[model samples]
Target: MTAHQLLGSDRHRDLRVRAERGAALGDAVMTSLVVPAEFRRVQDEYPILFRMNQERTDFVALALFGFENGENLFLKGDRWDARYRPLALAIQPFLIGHAAPDSDVRQVHVDTASPRISGDGEGIRVFDGDGRPTPYLEEVAELLGELDAGYRESAAFFAALRQHNLLEPFTLEIELDDGSINRLVGYHAIDEQKLAALGPDALGALHGEGHLMPIFMAVASLGRIAELVARKNQRNADG
Candidate 1:
């Protein structure tokens, strides 16, 4: 179904409106959840250029979704950056994904876009000059298929978070290739003390065990409540 369709119902529209207005923490989480699906859609419909940003090598995935309106959506995530900024931009699609040399990295360019694929000392690169490429129709279609599958699996996890009302307040800290660090903070609430107790090694172990996301989601939910209470107290004092 189309995005508009997914967001067409009154309940979904209400959530969307609240999210657009920055009303609820859950809204932000839902927004993050929808972005990968949208990116998958773009990968299916248009030519996407993929390359590695070696300077910021921590990013696990990045994609630019160009629309007909001269706008683009930049979606990126890193294992270190706790914040999931989906729909992060409205620019051209310049997508990248971090893959180990042994990992499978895929790119797809549409026939209408001028597509070129090359390899550098670092990794494989794909470019679409006119934003159209006709030669790799089958390849592009397969890439989209894979992304769609990934989206579905990820969405299931996102949906669970939403159901638990634990979407915002978690943050991601990423260490890039340059040794600089970036943090992405979520709107969901969290307990700094509890998170600190977990420590980096415990957190890493949890992530390795596939429990990190859920745990982070729970922390973020609590953190959001803490923030709200603090803000309310500040407002009361001002009054």
Candidate 2:
């Protein structure tokens, strides 16, 4: 079970967070959920796709990191090889959440059980001795604020996609060098043919509403599938 606590100076003044990546610290993953606000940068680094949320009410935009679950091809040794790491990964061990109804501000919470947390200066400090936010904590607050705003924007973006009947599901099959096949089923990506078929009026609406860029970025990201394939092959060859 996860033991997440509301991060505060009073109770966690001794808190230290390590801003590093390691497979032993649960860094392995197939994908990270992304937001429309980051589509431009994220598309350049990973294949962008949409997965059905557990509730099936909204589609989650994802940056593909590996062909299968519990694996991340971008992670080599203790470092992430890609030039860009998704915001979702950068904000690990800390999450933005609400504390109660009628609360107007989002609060930051930490998973105390996370392997990254230490008391002996193993990581970033949450607060100084005077119970004040440190530079690192301030940056986290800003990032969390941006993430919250992005989520709100994404809700509207998904609504627009559904309104245009553009959401569709497809399967992807990956062949590894070791003669095993990895097939991803039930995931969805934007349909380019249908997108191109949109009427000028509809296209204009997407453009006017700032949705066209993300749509194109999502489609352009498909080109990165080959890059991921190469990484998987290299990993296999090295083994």
| Stretches of model 2 off by over 4 angstroms after superposition | none
Give the per-residue lDDT digits (tens) of candidate 2, residues 65-182.
9888888999997998888888887876888877786786789998898887875778788899999999998988888888888987998899899999887897889878888898
lDDT of each: 0.32, 0.88
Backbone clashes in each candidate structure, one number apiece?
31, 1
Query: Using lDDT as the measure, which candidate wins?
Result: 2
lDDT score, candidate 1, position 101: 44
Candidate 1 accuracy as TM-score: 0.25
Please provide, for model 1 over 181-230, each residue's C-alpha lDDT reduced to its tens digit, 9 standing for 90 to 100: 54434223334465566658766765664546544433333334333233
Q: Tell me each candidate's TM-score.
A: 0.25, 0.95
Error of 2 at 220 (Å): 0.5
